[model samples]
Target: MGELEQKFAAAFLTEGRWILYFKGLGVTLGIAVLAAILGVIFGTVLGIMKLSFREDGKKTLWNILATAYVDVIRGTPSVLQLLIMWFIVFATWNNGVAVASISFGLNSAAYVSEIVRGGILAVDVGQMEAGRSLGLSKAMTMRYIILPQALKNMVPPLGNEFITLLKETAIVGYVSLTDLTRAANQIASRTYEAFMPLIGTAVIYFVVIKILTLLLGVLERRLRESDQR
Candidate 1:
């Protein structure tokens, strides 16, 4: 037990190294949460634009632009996108957190746009027809009838997407930002022990993801309950 304690002490407790982990956690959560918000907002707009052709199957400019955005983002590597944003687009900006947040948000928006478009399309055709039959216009039916039902379908996928974005934030280290994974790597370099730092970081990530999964489950249950009522 003393040997185990020594290893633990050397890995984490030495010279206030544990502070690194806490700082990294703050950066990770901050960038992920901010990125998720931006993704949802921008993705919703892209999704709406992507659906612009649904009315008459015409290829509108908005739909074309949205399609191009989604395609390019999906085709490229996320790390490259981060590098481009940091080294080129926001080169003068020294805020690593903000840069990472925007980069990940842009990447996430592509996928989230697809999710949003699918969720909206998944609603029953009858729902829209029924709304229109009741003297509602296309936009009104979409807002009043279709969207409410679609929200439930959207929740699960959106939750999953945000969770993925959370994990992907680990790459923020490429920009010299000491996020969680980077913190652990730094710890390993300091202590010359891979087991403790890496494993500890993995545990931290698993705990966060598990908690989020549980919360999503609760939300799903509530959505079901609302449907029943």
Candidate 2:
């Protein structure tokens, strides 16, 4: 076999090393999916808080707090945030996957909040006023009327955020988790050939992300079609 073929074999086909990639991919997806869900949930609340203001056009305490949270998370590097979360915030926790998910989720939430805030604002202000005129509570209007309209605006950016989160989870290795990137690194350490393992890992990531992007495109089309009807 040629050197490249030998390296490929050693990196993957030999000794069932492919299982490592599979397992690591699972972890990577787990963290990304869980983190995306968590980020959306918390980020929505943060976005709402940020939008809260007094009738006098002054910011509420909730707005200040939410803004501070978003600011702090956005200001720091994600790797440093991950390290802090893993080593300090979750020091006693042995479940690196869960910790990493929470860490990345919190990080993603900062950006997601801005996306959500923008989506909510993109919704026509008259929608809220109309709901209120119909005797709907503000909360009910936000839930059934405003949020549904805003969701279409949110989906595209939210997909981007999820993709970014997926890539960022590569640093979960800092927490001792053998995610896809770390799995490739380990395989390369043993195989003594960086090209095959590293490039293979990159290829896997690209393929997965491309699939996600296609899915998002489909969803956007469906939303557009629904609106046209």
Best by lDDT: 2
TM-score of each: 0.96, 0.96
Error of 2 at 158 (Å): 0.2
CA shift at 21, candidate 1, in angstroms? 0.6
Report, for all candidates in order, the number of backbone clashes: 0, 0
Q: Which tens-of-lDDT digit does each residue in 1-229 have in candidate 2?
A: 5977888899999999999999999999999999999999999989989999999999999999999999999999999999998889888999888998899899998899999999999999999999999999999999999998999999999999999999999998877899999999999899788899899999999999999999999999888886856
The TM-score of candidate 1 is 0.96
lDDT by candidate, in order shown: 0.93, 0.94
Off by over 4 Å in 1: 54-56
Cα lDDT tens digits, model 1, 110-156, are: 99999999999999899988999999999999998898888899999
